[model samples]
Target: MSDWEDEAEEPSAGKQRPRAPASTPWMPPQSHKQRSYREEGGDQPPTRERAWEPRGQREGDRGGFRRPEERSWSSRELPRQPETVTGGGWSRDFRRQEANRELASAPLCFRLDSSVVGTVIGRGGSKIRELEESSGSRIKITKGDYDSEVKIFGSSEQQDKAKTMIDDLLERYDERPETDTRFGYKEIRPSRSADMSTTVTAPVKRGINWASLRENREKYEIMKWADLPPMEKNFYKEASNIASMSQDEVTRWRKDNNNIICDDLKEGQKRPIPNPIRNFRDAFDHFPEIMSTIKKVGFDRPTPIQSQAWPIVLQGIDLIGIAQTGTGKTLAYLLPGFIHLDLQPLPKNERLGPGMLVLAPTRELALQVKAECSKYTYKGFKSICIYGGGDRKGQINVVTKGVDIVIATPGRLNDLQMNNFINLKSITYLVLDEADRMLDMGFEPQIMKILIDIRPDRQTIMTSATWPDGVRRLAKSYLKDPLMVYVGTLDLAAVNTVEQRVFIIPEEEKRAFTLHFIDSLKPKDKVLIFVGKKIIVDDLASDFSLQGIAVQSLHGNREQCDREQALDDFKKGIVRILVATDLASRGLDVHDITHVFNFDFPRNIEEYVHRIGRTGRAGRTGESVTLVTRKDWKVASELISILERANQEVPEELFEMAERYKHFKIKKDSERDMIPRQGRWRDNP
Candidate 1:
């Protein structure tokens, strides 16, 4: 595992740069002979055929990464490699070398052979001094300092010219055969670039290329976790019970397990996983720090999504993991992501955009991911969580310094990028944390724009509870050879981890049933109550407070600080009941929560499933109780389907009500219409 690896000529395992010819300064008297950056001797025997891996950042950089396969290194035979021209990106084929005064400066180092080191730092360091002035960059002449490595530090253009100068200087002094490097340099290679057109593009539109995303999913590369090599596999090896299940047995198991059905999956040109891991340790064996962090977080095993996603991501493959909410989906990516970081640890003080970018849909989820990052964080690793409602200047200050990982919502990440306050050129890993929600909330334009900023060669990981047509289309555009993983049933079935109940009550008496249910909850247990609208969340929290219940409500409009505090209070057991709108539905992982109450049913099954997912996490048994009224009848059937999926008993009346409202649909009117047709749906009423 060398500290550095060469970049891709083809779209290799992950986005890494070609061992670019060091930018040159001298013209050869004759047209120059050339060679690959790694092939120093044209006729020399090839060094052991190397496993392709992620590129390492230069010393003092804070953004480096390596995957599992690339961690082997022989320190004795190595020289410090200069940073690649493209920063191991997938965005563009080559650097435009545009004089965008905004691109920050960094020190570049090239290790010189011991023999010619004296020639470059000639009499009294005069040659090195002269080279620096000509290139308009600072050149440090490290006299016998391996760490210094004849370093050139400054803006990108200056570094390019400086490298060229060094190459020429070396050529002039050494009569030895021209080795692995070229007497020539190539401009950056070609890759996808942002077109930057304002007009709507076909690929960015919803459901535009679903045919590709909807093809057979089973055709993807599938490998068993038990079958991997000693270095590649997890430490704990028990043959998977899943492997023994026949295709029919798998379907039967999924019927009760609340996992994605093979039938529901349509891999968007699946990047095959020859051997996907099924445990937490195998996917994260590269680094001890990550292993320590996982234990601190108390995650004993891999969730369904984690097991399948680990190997593909470990190999630097792009991924789209579609799993139900609260299945440790966050950790599935984060832990293995740690292994990737270990594979190519960033330099101590990197001064560019983060190598890893995680785009979450909501602010809460972003904060949650940030918290998880803290728990599993490595000592050299740095990250910033940015979203709206936070201090913009504060976030900007963090971005200017550079980071290893960025956890952000689409809008904020895009805005910072647009304002030129942040850079994405060097990013090697990109994650669409909740791809479905981002698209559903009309973030395609922002997401597409962010996609362009990243190197086109970066590894992309997208996760969602439901794989909608639009998200699939978005996946096809950004991800290349992504392994699509389904953890739970792709349908919006409630997680089988929680027990479910439906209580049919009249609209006016619904509050009584809710009160009765609340009274029945154990005194110490935490509960989450969901309402459809933001105002109702506030109203219910207020009413429940009067009823002597300790409750806090959350929604989109609250200040970021308030939402953070509320969630903290709930998780700390200060608040036993937290009421909220759909904002709290997707990813609120409070392990002690014992129940979920849908006071007002959601607009869709996806919302309902996510709402209840607030409870029943980390192997905790929990319950979901829905008070079904005539107003809820229309979509009541969705609840029945999910209940059936979880093998729960669906009350007969629920089916009757679903059919009754099957022909009924809500209508818009100038006057506020009430759910009960009496209590109007507004604050004034």
Candidate 2:
């Protein structure tokens, strides 16, 4: 089982490089004329009959005249050769030397298969180096528009020697069967190439591309824990299963199951996991001035996301953080900024622009970042929160004064940048918080435009609860050599402490069912309801108010001041029930939400996670109920797949309906809005 194997010859295999062009002349030079064939055979030997006459026939003086086949080294005696060599290296092939000289002047070229170029490079051109050394020729491998090839050139003798070595290399290279490599797998080859016609032989393998594998290794590593092959189906299935399991359940399962997996996919064998945190604590501790600033803010222990990410960021590597909401992403980037800032200080008067820019999806989330930043704002280090909806005059004033960090929403930040209220060119560190939400909200273009205004050499960091396509693409463009940190998959529902349940109800009884669900809530149980439309929000809020339940509505249609009031009241528990549309589903940071009621099922499963995420904050347990109508039964079942992946329990009734009508589509009138008509309800009242 040799690791080096030439791929089997097959019609599907890619074409190989052509043979090296033949050198025109193959003869010795005037300097070495004595060794030339012409010099040795200038005078022909005598005829065999005459030479073998009498004495030779009788005594073997005719040794040279023996049968051609009998001229064996073992049987023949040594000849008395001349002591001195022939004269002046007898007549050389001056023409051959002239041809070699001309050929060496021309560019030496040989084309190889593009596919095997990587294998030939062999970790910093080691394989290529070996080839050049063996062939006694200077080599240059180049990739261009048409394909890739290698070129060699040297003195006439050296080039000829190189040509022979290349032929042998290609012969050995072409013998092995083609095998694709998975990530980190290594193999060897007898020679650089197998095809004698071309020097393009290299062992290749079929598996994950290194870039893709490196980007998604955080996820793939988990799959390896299950001892599954590196397939998409395997990754998704295991990710879902792992996502659904509780921490305790996963722990117990690992102890009992023989095939339990970890992030790197090591089974039976423990993997060499790197230190989760770089010396961030040491960095903070060594810089007492910064430590004083951090300690004053109650920075005792690093959060899970912080523990994994800060060290990598401080190490100045890129990062892909994969933690859920409320995991303290602010500190993850903030700690690194502080460490970097403390180490490299700037003059006070010169701090007119932000050193770090943290972009959040919404004003509230941006404000939240600023608030978190405040805790660490000691010893002249400060951050300003900037977003629309508030007084711009004040925001401008704050920006004008200069701050160490600026936490902002994309649109507002752009507005300020356009107005010349802030200078983005000075930004050294960039952070995109809740990247999935920003992208989902259609802030990508503005985010990109803002990034374009800043320095390209800046350190960029992005945090997201979900790894959506938009976020992934943005990460590719913005970050360089990022260290990916994935705590869990995005669609894992009710993470930490929220019990997700669904109730199947008829469409006609939807409102009544919601009322019943709300009535069941105990006193002071803060509940958040997620609705699809703005009209439903108003109707639901009215319905709850009339029902003697303290509630308020928050949606995009409302005036900015009014929306703020509603959110503020909800946060204060002044209104225990806050009915909101999708706007609040993402960056609304009210931690006291005890229950989240999906008065209507979300349009998609990802929305479902965001809705439920509002509750279950700060280690407090929360509960969520999805009021599913007959029309939603099918979608509910599809939704259960996500829940099951998150390891949440699905209601049996919902599952049963899905099982019965798996192929069925729920029919509904286009006009059947979740928000009931106001006239009839008001007239009845």
lDDT (Cα, 0-100) at 636 in candidate 1: 75
Steric clashes per prediction? 36, 34
In the range 565-619, model 2's lDDT, one tens digit per residue, is: 8888888888888888877777777778888999888876667877888888756
Model 2 weakest 10-residue run by lDDT: 229-238
TM-score of each: 0.58, 0.55
Candidate 1 weakest ten by summed lDDT: 196-205
Task: Report the CA-based lDDT of candidate 2 relative to the real structure.
Answer: 0.63
Indicate which candidate wins on TM-score: 1
TM-score for candidate 2: 0.55
301-411, model 1: which lDDT tens digit per residue? 666667666655666666788887777777777766655554544443543557778888888888889998887767678889999999999999988876788999889
